[model samples]
Target: MRNQVLLIIVLLSALLGAPVATTAAEGISISETVLKMPLADDVSMDDAVDSMKLRANTLNFKLVAHLPLYKELEAMDIETNRIEIFQFCDARIANEMVIFNPDFSAYLPCRITLLEDADGKPWLVTLDLGKIIPSANLSPELLEKAKMVRDKIESIMQAGANGEL
Candidate 1:
């Protein structure tokens, strides 16, 4: 049954001239699935996080939760670089998305992660919604909303990277 579904998808993609997301032997490309931005040398992690929070608020996205993962690991005596996650949501759009497709619930409340590389350079990362949303087969109206969400996320990332409030 799974093979049948896969065949059908391949046929459809061929007819449409769209590239299949993956093959039986291939994994998803990291470049296609993630968006990452590096912080400027002068911008501290605190400033970037503050800028992101301020941008989210300005865009009316609720800062739902924050997880200071590094602190927890530190408590466990695990030596690791700084890592934190911030979750944001627009409830109205999120609800509409779930109503349209239950699977979307799995992606609810978008997330951004902040981490420091081995060299101690800060970076912000998030899912590349631009690549995911087009495959969801959303209605035109919902598609616009989804794109808005993606844009807002990119905006927030930019603000954080630039340390712009």
Candidate 2:
């Protein structure tokens, strides 16, 4: 009986130890795209982007923990960065362009992270938007659109983890 129990433990550990694979969010085949953005001479854009990435990871972990379809997401190997466009990509969703707010001491309208890839394109990711900008109402329409986008991204990530991507 002891030997059977030991065998079961070993099997469980082996399965649990296996790496959970994940692909980029949004079914977006994010092969190391190198995008570079012009940075203010004195600012640390890279560091700011890194900070946002950390927050994104935390957000993803929390979401996974809360959602049933993404329990395995806690173990996912994922990455993200910030991207900016001169013209908005999805204007229907958000009219205002999202940018990095380096300082957040008093009141922040938006929290921005500029992520740079090997090639140097900076992707701008954001969070804490509502708190940062307490005065302005983030449109309900935009929020719902954002939720849809997030769901699609999560789906893609799960598919990637399952080697379906």
Candidate 3:
């Protein structure tokens, strides 16, 4: 039978380390994370960071670090402006996540950057855990924790973008 013959071919190919056949070789993966949101029209870069910090504080995510990228660049004599990052964390949430998988530390103390483009409109950008969650193989409870943290992060970033909360 044709199906039997194909099965034999597939087994032999597997032994030879060949790729399995599929209808489309260019399938797009769902692991991609989309981040980056528009800032309030008339807001300045500093205002963006301020708004983000306020929102994070309201949610009990303590401020961890504030890195001024533009200033750091200037220290090396590179002329640039309107770029910095705000790092914060909720230890309880982070602890619950790590217990499920220590490898999740790579995403700890989440950060968001505030930057402006040529038009001087500020922007808030950060990575989405959903982008990395698929491969993380988290359990239902851990997945819920991840989503909870992710939701908080997105909410904070959006609040900062709107220059409110």
* Candidate of highest lDDT: 1
What tens-digit string does per-residue lDDT give for candidate 2 at 1-165? 543343334332222222233255522111211111234344354353333334435444222211111223334643323332111123223333232222221221222223344454333332323222333344665455455434433332323222231
Off by over 4 Å in 2: 1-137
Per-residue alpha-carbon lDDT of candidate 1 for residues 17-136, written as tens digits (9 for 90 to 100): 235567547545334466789998888999999999999999999999998988998999999788888999999999999999887876778888888877787888787789878888
How many pairs of residues collide in model 1? 0
User: Between prediction 1 and prediction 2, which has the larger TM-score?
Assistant: 1
Model 2 residue 154 CA deviation (Å) reads: 0.6
The runs of at least 3 residues in candidate 3 whose Cα sits more than 4 Å from the true structure, single-residue gaps closed, are 1-32
lDDT of 3 by residue, 46-148 (tens): 5667778888888888889887877888899987646777888989878977887675675677877676655665667666566666677888887787787
Report RMSD (Å) for each prediction in the order shown: 8.3, 18.9, 12.5
Task: List the global CA lDDT of all models.
Answer: 0.81, 0.31, 0.68
Q: State candidate 1's TM-score.
A: 0.84
Candidates by TM-score, descending order: 1, 3, 2
TM-scores of the models, in the order given: 0.84, 0.23, 0.74
The best-first sequence of candidates by lDDT reads 1, 3, 2
What residue pairs clash in candidate 3, if any at all?
Answer: none
Per model, state how many residue pairs clash. 0, 12, 0
